[model samples]
Target: MISVEEALRIILEESKALEGEEKNILSCLNKVLAEDIYSRDNLPPFDKSAMDGYAIKSEDTDLYKDGVSIELEIVDLIKAGESSDKELKNGQAMKIMTGAPVPEGANAVIQIEKVEVREDTLHISEKVKNGCNVIKLGEEIKVGDIALRKGTLIRPTEIGVLASLGYSKIKVPRNPVVSILTTGDELVEINETPKFGQIRNSNEYSLKALIQNLGLEALSFGIVEDKKDTLKSKVKEALEKSDIVITSGGASVGDFDFVEQVLNEINADIKFQSVAIKPGKPISFAVIDKKLFFSLPGNPLSAITTFEEFVKPACEKMLGKNMESDNTFPVILAEDFKEKEGRSKYIYVKIKAENGKLYAYKAGSQSSNQLITMSKANGIIIMPEGIGYKKAGEVLSGKFIFK
Candidate 1:
């Protein structure tokens, strides 16, 4: 068995960023930009109005005093999506709505509420500064200017910006196709009642949910018998149809654990068969034909934890996303915890923020097969591989799970 850090290093070294394809802007949400996007036109194509008010020359309001008001004739009215070609004179103003194009020779706009109108005339007692309430053309972005840089994640705001810049489609890295294969004769369908020694298969469902949480689709091959030949054929089939194949059982050293054997038989480069981590120690990683393969323990919690720690990074790299950042932080323990002193332990806990400091408390039993314990936990505290027990008031690294 190798350390978790070394195993992850091998997996990431083999994962490659996939090529990009053109897609509608709406479909590119949460995806990384494949290239820099230049603005096709000025952000505000014309001198536009930022408010519903009168467009006038700033010089026209220069004579206004505290008690005295200045009046300018209202010549034309412009609403949103409308343009006026009529130019304003020294004492003329145009009633313009928000988003309407400001008429030529108008250098400022006085808000409608700030001014009183008396029969086609505008009245204002305050001096209007130049460019006031006017969204100048190209103020935000100019034609041929870089609007968005490569590797930027597309959000809702990016969608609107792309649309405003006349881009209906964008190029983004393709989401990888992931397949889940569950193995074990002792497992039955979720809807089926398990016999005396059998148990319902929850690993397949949990794996699918985890894959979907990354915005990728999952194809699951129902439970395969513990037979060597059958599992081998299914593994080959899954690898042939998917960019990443995940098997949820038969990864340990038991007689029926055939993942490592099958990987060798298939001529795959089996990088590692185990990691020094609790609840998810038996994890097999391999690569063949540009496809990633991960064999996780049959325990439901182990399967989910290994997937998040190992498989999730491969998928993220294929999608051209940042792969090195984690949300871990120093958290003070509020309860004592016990464990063996060999592998790293991920203890599920309920985290609370008190006075700007995070404190972690035990949620329930730290059993490897208990998914309920994980469900009750909002976060996890990482215990070092050299420590067997942690006392209350001790500090350790903690981070939220499934995020």
Candidate 2:
């Protein structure tokens, strides 16, 4: 078996960049931007008033002392969205509202509440400072500046910025369509109660949820019986209609493990046979024509882990989105853990806070066939190769399922 890192490198080397599509501004939220967005024009576009006040020159006010009154002429009254027609001169002040353009030669703006206005003559009691309450042109953003870069995933704030820049449509990468096929003769649908020696088909539903969490769409093809002809037909049909094809249960080395055989029969070039990882050693990858195919283990926990660690990054990177995992953290073990000295082991454990100390305890049995243990686990404590039993207070890097 090849190391997990080597297998991943081989898989990503075959990743082809996804093409982009035109989307309406409303629908482009959270989609990766395919082109850089530059500002159409200067923000504010002109020198404007930042507050509702009287625009005047520094020499217009002589009432520096408190309660002292100086009579000045109100030459013009400007409201928001209106441009000033007259320039400010000595002994003249303009009543300007917030967002109104300040006239040329205007030095300061004294608030209306600070002055008493009788007809066109305004009495200013407080002295005004020079260049107060003014927003310079292009202060927020300049014209022709790159407001948003290409390959940026649009968020709520990015949408607001695009709208402010007068962008009603955006170019973004089309989301990849994942076709899920769960294979097993002993599996039954969720609606039907399982008969003796049969289990409910959980991989399909779980895989659908996992795809949704990555912001991708999943088209489920339900449970497939363990037969060569049926599996080939289904896999071929799914690959034809989907960008990525995923199948479970038929990947492992067993009498019924026919996924790899079917994929090879359909001419899917095998990229990697197996990875050195615990509970997911049967993971496989191949490419049919130009589409991607992932053969995950039959176990639910193994399927989810392999998908997150491998398949998700490939999909995200192809879509031009960030694919780095920021969930890895150092955790203190709550109990001793033993594993083989060569291959890395992912131990499912539940973490808790005890008197301000973070400790991780093994949830249940470590058997790969046991789903109850995986279900009860909150995180996976990573046990690297060459390490023996891990005792309490031993710090090991772990992946957190949730923050």
Candidate 3:
């Protein structure tokens, strides 16, 4: 067995980022950028009017101070997407809409609400400061400026920035294709009514959902029987088609456990057979033909916990992103909890804030087979090894899993 930190380090050190591909910006959401993107032009290509009002020289409104009103002749009207070549001379104003380019020689804009218009003339009651309500050219981003750095995850805001740069297509790291397989003789399809001593297959679907949530493609190979030959055949097929293969069950030491044997038969390089963690000690990791393989525990909670702790970071590394710990917070334990020596413990809990203090309440049973507790939990309390027991109100580090 190896520590979780050592296991993760091995996986990341062996992993390599996938090659880049040019994809349409519309379809690149959540993809990591492969190259730095620079702006081709200023964010606002020209001097823009920030408000829908009259554009006039700042000196024109100077005399209309302290309750005095000044009227100037309206020379032209400029709306968004429209340009005016006419220049504003003294005592002249232009009715410009928001986002419209400011006419030449106009240094300020007065909001329409602040002035009363009579025909082509405008009355401005307040003295407008120079450059007021006007977005100067290149105010936000200048030409050739680095708009986005490499390895940045593309979000909606990033999409807007790319659109402003006229990038219909962008280069991004390719998303890894994951294959999910489940093993057990007592497992039945989800639609079938399980007979005595049989259970429905839930891990496959849960793992598939989790893979999709990470913006990766998942191919399900269904459930394989707990036989060495059958498991070997399924593993071969998954390895041929996917960049990563994840299997649940048959990894622990038992009479029916044959996943390890199958991997050995295939001559896979086993990185680790076990990890020093509770509810997930039976986890296995191997690499076959330069492709990654993860053998998770059979229990539902254990499978999910191991996935979050190990597989998530591996996937991020493959997608050309720096691995970081999931968000965590310090919470006061609402109840006493015991930890086993020489093994880290992950306890499911629900977090609640009261009186500006965060509290973690144990959620249901912490058994690996109990799916109800995992479903109700919003966070996990990590209890390090050697800590015998913790009293209520003791501070513990917790990571939010949901919301």
What are the RMSDs of all candidates, in order? Answer: 2.0, 3.6, 2.3
lDDT by residue (tens digit), candidate 2, 158-179: 9999999999998888788899
Model-by-model lDDT, in order? 0.91, 0.83, 0.90
How close is every model to the real structure, measured as TM-score?
A: 0.93, 0.85, 0.91
Candidate 1's C-alpha lDDT? 0.91
Q: What TM-score does prediction 2 earn? A: 0.85
Report the poorest 10 consecutive residues by lDDT, candidate 2: 58-67
Between candidates 1 and 3, which one is better according to lDDT?
1
Winner on TM-score between 1 and 3 is 1
Better of 2 and 3 by TM-score: 3
Model 2: number of backbone collisions: 0
